[model samples]
Target: MTGTPRPRTVLLTGASGVVGRSILREPTALRLLAATHSAPAPEADGRRIRCDLTADRLGLEKEEYTALAGEVDAVIHSAGLTEWGLPAERYRPINIEGTRRVIEFARHAGATVHFMSTAFVAALAETAPVALSEGNMCRNYISSKWEAERLLRDSGIPHTVFRPTNLVGDSATGWTSKGQIVQLMSDWICRGRAPFLPAHAGIRMDFVPQDLLSKAVLRAIEQDVSEGEFWVTYGAEAMDMDASLRVLAKHAAYLGRDLTIPPVVDPDTLTAEQLAGLRPMVRNYVAVLRDVSEVTRCSGGVLPSSMPELRTRFGVPLVDDATAYLRSLEYASAHLS
Candidate 1:
């Protein structure tokens, strides 16, 4: 009788990132080769490889690169800059060129690739039916991701692109990477410094816990086919602005603080004085909120229908929106301060 077949060895980039670590936590039959740019790599089960995606050959030596290429059956490219305010020039090397290098490496290794991208790649439209499907126009950070996707598609390597929306903390412990824009907003709200927000009732905000996203990624790797685009999101089940604030208010009540819900201001109708009332940091989000509101107004707040089917097929759990928001607030309260 044949012995049990050995588990396929997969190389994972961005092993130090939020989603990367989450993927590392899940038990899987695959042997992981985790790559990191920093000195001290994650203390996990994988064979840690020090490599930079932006560097030539991912900064790996000739022998090391050849050995890795021979061993890896698949590659998951999750490492990249996600900061919003950075210029396109700054993001080009890491998000765009880095992806090109990843595809190149995958081709050499004869391995399939899984690319992590954001749902904002759909971009925001000014008119109705803002359906977030493939091939939408976006700019800045999102544009970098779009360009990377294009490179992957044209690379002639077997690949799947996953577009997840706003990622919250862990579903259970609410642990997450600090310095996200959501953390800033939560901080302002908890401090009672934010008196008003530019939002609309119809605006829908999608959030996926890192745990669920990681699981989905792993499933995609294990059940890999030639190619597909998966939108890892809650779709129409996502919470609206008012509902999200209510959840935050509930968390505030649990903490024994009577928080006043901020009034929503329409971005288009805001007077100069009204804009001046917002905190300097919060003011930057005005345009973002307006764009989202416009998308909601046009699309009736509907995400793609295939999202649910994909989530189910991948065994991703349906996270409770209120719990996810509360856990995020709790983590933000303790750490963001």
Candidate 2:
């Protein structure tokens, strides 16, 4: 019988992101070559390479980039512009072309690729369904990510695509940097701007904590799954936006006696002028609240179904949403404002 292959090497981009940080915490036998466009990170175990993905050669010449690429067995492309309000040109350079560069580097280096994508790629408009899956069409950021995915697939490099939902983690510890979405939610829950009614409540956003997302990506790396798509999430049943908010409320109550998170508010009740004058904190809270509520109301109930292949084939563990949600809240409260 043949023995299992030795642990392979990995070149991980976005070493500081919500999912990327989680992946870095666990001890893996693989040789990790972690790269980031951000400022140099504190010294750690892995081989660290600093490169801006938007650069023509990803800030490395063909020979140097190829040399570094040849040293790794797989590439997990997590670096990209994730801002919703970013211009298309801005997003295209990093998210699109940068992805293409990863694919090229992986292919030339004869390494496998893991593409970090978003479920938001399923739709951009409010009419898009909330519970999108692999088969769903691309819209908004989903559209650009879909374009990136297509390029990777066409590159003929062996690849695994991960489409994750909202990410939850602690920001104070630098475990998870607060994204725009999370920041908005934090504002609402901390400042008491969320609505009270079910209809007016934020949409049922599917969320996966950093740990789960990291695990799924690790699983994809360890196993030679078919080159296709997979959704890394806590599962459909776990994505209860309102219930998650309640947990946030509980956390606030625990942190400060004066803090009281309100129930969901009806959008029709708030005048434009009233919402306009809100502090940055309050505005973010209202925006996310309204956005989620409006989208969820339009999309109907339930998150996208889980991909059983991720578990039955690769043995990835399922995470408890309430537990993850609460942990995230506690961590954020202790660290970030």
Number of backbone-clashing residue pairs for each candidate, in the order shown: 2, 8
Estimate, for each residue in 52-153, the C-alpha lDDT of model 1 and write its tens digit: 877999999989998999999899898998876566798999999999989889999999999998776655433435443232223477779989998998
Cα RMSDs, all models: 3.5, 4.7
lDDT tens string, model 2, 162-225? 8877777732232455543654466455655544332344446566666666766777677754
> lDDT, candidate 1, residue 243?
77
Give the lowest summed-lDDT range of ten residues in model 2. 131-140
| Clash pairs for candidate 2 | 121-142, 195-263, 195-264, 195-265, 196-263, 196-264, 196-265, 203-292
Candidate 1 regions exceeding 4 Å error are 1-3, 39-43, 124-138, 177-179, 276-279, 285-300
TM-score of every model? 0.88, 0.81
Quote the positional error of residue 294 for candidate 2 in Å: 4.9
Please give the distance, in angstroms, between residue 97's alpha carbon in candidate 2 and its true position after superposition: 0.9
Give Cα distance to truth, residue 12, candidate 2, Å.
Answer: 0.8
Q: Candidate 2: which stretches are off by over 4 Å?
A: 1-6, 124-140, 170-180, 193-202, 239-241, 258-281, 292-301
